[model samples]
Target: MTDAVQQKEANTRVAWIAGVGASAGLGAALARRFARGGLSVAVTGRSRERLDAIVAEIERAGGQALALPGDVTIESELAAIARQLVERGTLEVAIFNAAGATRAPTLDLSAGQFEAAWRVTTLGGFLFARAALPPLLATGRGSLLFTGATASLRGRPPFAAFAAAKAGLRSLAQSLAREFGPRNIHVAHVIVDGGIDGERLRTSAPQRVAERGPDGLLDPDDIADAYWYLHQQGRSAWSHEIDLRPFNESF
Candidate 1:
């Protein structure tokens, strides 16, 4: 290849964020954060419209972004995303933020419901990491970040299914970190310890939002900032797991 082409490739860095939803959600915030930092971002989710809207917003802010819509639970889709990322640019960061779980009584939670939660958060994370690692390894320096919840550490009432799934994901992140850290890959699991102040919570539990008062809920942008910080850390000081919560939130 010509020197000009080589230079172009060297300058191009990409960050892939999965599970993007609302424009005000954490996933969208992550995409915008990485893009603002000069890394071209590729966002994926089941909703093409949502992904496109996020891409547009990023572009409007003078950042490059592409929408690669697909279900995180599908193995085939993740493999295809890997190929697309390779074709697009050097993937310097890959974040698995897909979460699938619903609060229901233990008796009401069917086996299928329990498994579905695992498939989306745990299984999907495995597939995404498997697919993303190749490109990341090619770069020889990449960061894989997983989003976890308070459930990752404890199972509360009505959230048994969600807790189990997040716990599994946490374990997965740990294993990957142990195996990949020696290879120069940074794997981190971020435990979001409080309710997020975003579209989902605001729409679903407006009353809860009010009860939290100012700075009670975790800000999506602040969460995104944490991810960004993790990705930028030096190898010697790398952190494998971190918990984020509001100041007033109990541990």
Candidate 2:
């Protein structure tokens, strides 16, 4: 390939991951994965400090990274994220990892809490996809991935709000995949079952570390591997949705 052509190829390799969450678990791992692959990465979240920290880690490892801290719940903020990427280059991969879960009995849950859950998971997923898709479609070929939870399929117990939100997101993914697949834009959703072994989950439920035992909790890095795999799938055999869990996690 000619030098100019090769340089253009490198410039077009960009990935955007949103909803870094408090500890930046899956989002940070994904940023590292793509950055290490030599792609220009832009990460977004409500926490500026956490985003910067992730950006620093990637940069320290000799990878390019940009931190654009913003809330996934806001439409304008998400639009700005998309605008920034379009101004700089193109969106090759857009991953929505922002999620929130609220545990409360239907009778005890406050209206605010229920609304907040839907805002972050369902509405937020819609806004992110709306902003990310145009740019992704501009690339002629790219991936739009959403991180889902087991709640996506089942609504049980104290997770009514979370389950409803996730189910909505899954539905959104399905609709988008069918609409954009023919245009070469691959949209997929991943249902992450079980507890993710990370700073947030480990610290929150220390006692469960032993309760579940070996291979009980899901690995963030391992889940990240699946995200990368989905992004790399060939157009001839694209996967619309995938479920991930630890080996010992029950169905």
Off by over 4 Å in 2: 1-10, 22-24
Displacement of residue 115 (Cα, Å) in model 2 is 0.8
For residue 78, give model 1's deviation from the true position in Å: 0.7
Q: Candidate 2, clashing residue pairs?
A: none
TM-score of 2: 0.94
- The sequence of per-residue lDDT tens digits that candidate 2 reaches over residues 1-251 is 78787677547678999977544377888888888766788999887888888888888899988899888899999999899888657689999988778899999999999899999999999999999999888779899999999999999979999999999999999999999999999899999999887777777778987788899988888888898899999998999999999989999
| Residue 163 in model 1: lDDT | 96
TM-score against truth, every candidate = 0.97, 0.94
Clashing pairs in 1: none
Each model's total of backbone clashes: 0, 0
